[model samples]
Target: MQVETLVVVPVVLVAFVFYLTHNQTGLPRVGKSGPFGFILTALKSITSFADLLDEGLNKYGSKAFVVPTMAGSLIVAGPENVDLFKSSDDTAINQPISVDESLQLMHTLNSRQLALPFQAVVVRTDVTRAISAFIPEILEETRLAMAEAFALPFGEKSTTLPLFHTMTHLVARISNRAILGPSICRQEQYLHDIIRFAETLSIYGQLLTWFPRILRSPVYFLLSSAFGGPKEPARAIIPHLKMLLAEREQGLENAKTITDFLINLAPPEEIADVKLLAMRVLSVNFGSIHTSSIFGTHALFHLATLSESELDTIRHEIIEALESEGGYNKASLAKMRILDSTLREVGRFYALGVVCLNRVLIKPASLVDGIVVPSGYNITIPLKPIHFDENVYPEPYKFDCFRFSKLRASDHTDLKYGFTTVEKDFVPFGLGKHACPGRFFASMELKIMLSHLLLNYDLSLPGGAKEAPKPIFFNSHVIPDTKACVILKPRVGQAGQDL
Candidate 1:
């Protein structure tokens, strides 16, 4: 009886899933069809999603296809239909809903964050507008961070540092210097909590997706850091945030940080809530620290492989830009066209994911050829494939640091190829109105830090390796080699040129 019960239960569940998925979409599928196929595809999605996308595009051409995942089916639209992804009809296709569904934010994070995105709004407005004013702060923090993270001996000696870890540390400190302020940003405990929270949220969010939706909230509540099952660093930072909020109420006016902007932009009723404000800060840190550090590491790794003369070419551009503009301000950074191209090229090469512009349809939407996508289906653009399209980028796989700079030189009148420019083809920061609002700030921050590194130090792969370690790809994320090390030596005869 017991053996029969076990076999029957397995059969029943598979049959039920098969029933639910049958005829769910009219679009072509990238993998085998049916419940058993779904299981296989879901496993492949976790391990080799990019391969799955490549197979889909190769098989279906420019037509849309579905890729199954643990979360749900993703309707991947090809390059030809990218404009449909730029639709502003929030009621039909919504990016926030897609994010919430993808990350399971309603359970893992505070649902209020999804509903009230005051932090993002502040980033889109206050952060971008204040970039020029905070240039000195960013550069100072970059200098201090580099000195501390890579404290090598002067002349004929070098220190090897873990690339991703050091970049994260540098970005966290420098970004928080702009996000919170100088004193709090430097606090060891506070910085630890912020980094821990971002990591915890990412891990737990993906973990929770494997469970049934009905059990997710209960599972999260039971195992969350508040209950001592998992680490919730957001809770750890509440007191520090409350104190900051109190200081704000007591007339501590700081117009330069996100804290001030949140207070300025948030509704009066939500302003004094410590948990709300703490979560907001955590969200901002997660977005800034994780993504910036990843791409920063990518750019540095590519730079590490370059010949000394190639490095000098970029260094010379930075020095000229600084001299031409008299300082490290917005205008000066803008003049560093090669620096911008280097960063942009790294993005185009080591993209963040296999797809972008993910949206969840709340209502039925029709596309070309009278194909109607049913409500609640997830949609994504094939970003990685588009980035590597031979028709779009010549020698797309090569790490040509001057790719965009050469493009700009040809046109001379077009800013479309700039680092911050977003189009259908090049979309590391995403595309359209819902694109990353903090890109202007991120671009400035990354450029400043990279410029500082170029001027003050020389970087090479440890042990004289010709290339940096290969980046790791898991599920959809393209992460820089987290454990890779780079040798850093003080640049000779470049003391006064440091940012």
Candidate 2:
């Protein structure tokens, strides 16, 4: 009467059914075409799928399938589909719910409530209106941030430092100035707390995604309480924000920055929710710091590795722009075509987000060629394939600092360099209506940081380190491997030039 026989029978039956269905379905084979192929396919795809995805796209044209995880299948859409998917009119087809979910998970861990303040205040506007109100405040903060960063230790060193860490600190300072204004920006502890809070939340958010919903809340509380979670930072900063809001209400009459805009524009419901405001401030910091830092490092690293003459030419362009305009401003920075091209090239080569631009199919749709895609199938664009295509960009592997500049030079008609524009071919800031709204501020931040670094320091790889830093890919997103070091040294005569 042992129960062993009963358990074994059901287990065997289930296995047999799985085998039959897996074979009969004729769904895309992920790895080797054999029984139980999905396991091997998933392993292979995750390990080196970028190259494999590219190869599959080359062979299959517009639609190919890759098995990135055994949990689900990835539908690799072609360039035409990329255009359609990005510009999709249907909500389900272009859902932003995933990002929203991630934000909610962050809120749970921090024990903070969620609010959509940004959607009401910022994302509702067209680009022109958004930029007009925000750009000047961003620029003013950029100057203050640059001055603060240079005053720190290793601030004026000519020796190379760790690029990612240095850039992170610099961007944090910049973001604090923009989001919190000058008084809070000068507080060292507040700046440090913001950086720590962002780093902690990112790790926790990733963890919560893999666990069951019921377990997330309790687990988050345990982890966050053990570590100094968002609560600690919120506790410290909430009082300051309240004071700031009170001061503003009392007619301080400062220039209308993001903080002021959010306070004034968010719906009463959202404004009453302090947690939502905190989340918005945190979101801005998270978006601005990591992204601008990566781009800033890439641009600096490329400039450092170039030959002396190339470096001199770029330097001359910077000096001329500065002299002509008498200083760095939005208009003068825009005129530095060489630097623009260099930054664009860096973006093209080192885009951090990989294959996970998820869109849930809203309706039965077909491509121009009549390939039918049923509703509810998730569509994803593999950024690396588009970025590395030899047809789109000749000799895609070679890092030509002037690649975009050359394109612009040959065809001044090409408007890829314009700040507010986006395209399928170049999507570092993403594309369509949901594309990053803060790119103008990001561009100014990168330009100011680079302009300051180039004018003040000489940078290079450590002696005997022959190669530039290479990126390590996780899933599909590419990140600079932190193990590589770039040395920086202050220029001899340039020490006090700007000071």
Q: CA lDDT of each candidate?
A: 0.79, 0.62
- lDDT per residue for candidate 2 within 1-499, as digits (tens), equals 5699799668754664343224322224345655446546555654566766666666676664544332234556666667776777655565454444444444443323233435333533432254434445555665565455444355445444677766777777766666667677667777677767766665566555434455567777887777656665565556655765778789885644456555665556545767656655566666677677777777777777877678677777788777787666656677667777777887778775566455655566665456666554555677766777899989998877788767777887446655335687777777776677767767766776676677666667777353568876644456666666676665658522342
Off by over 4 Å in 2: 1-29, 32-52, 101-157, 200-203, 222-229, 362-369, 374-377, 418-420, 464-466
What lDDT tens digits, residue by residue, belong to model 1 across residues 317-413? 8888888899899888998888799888877887677677878888988766567888778887787567898888988878888899888989894
C-alpha-based local distance difference test score of model 1: 0.79
Off by over 4 Å in 1: 1-23, 153-156, 221-223, 226-237, 495-499
The 10 consecutive residues of candidate 2 with the worst lDDT sum are 20-29
The alpha-carbon deviation from the true structure for residue 212 of candidate 1, after best TM-score superposition, in angstroms, is 1.1
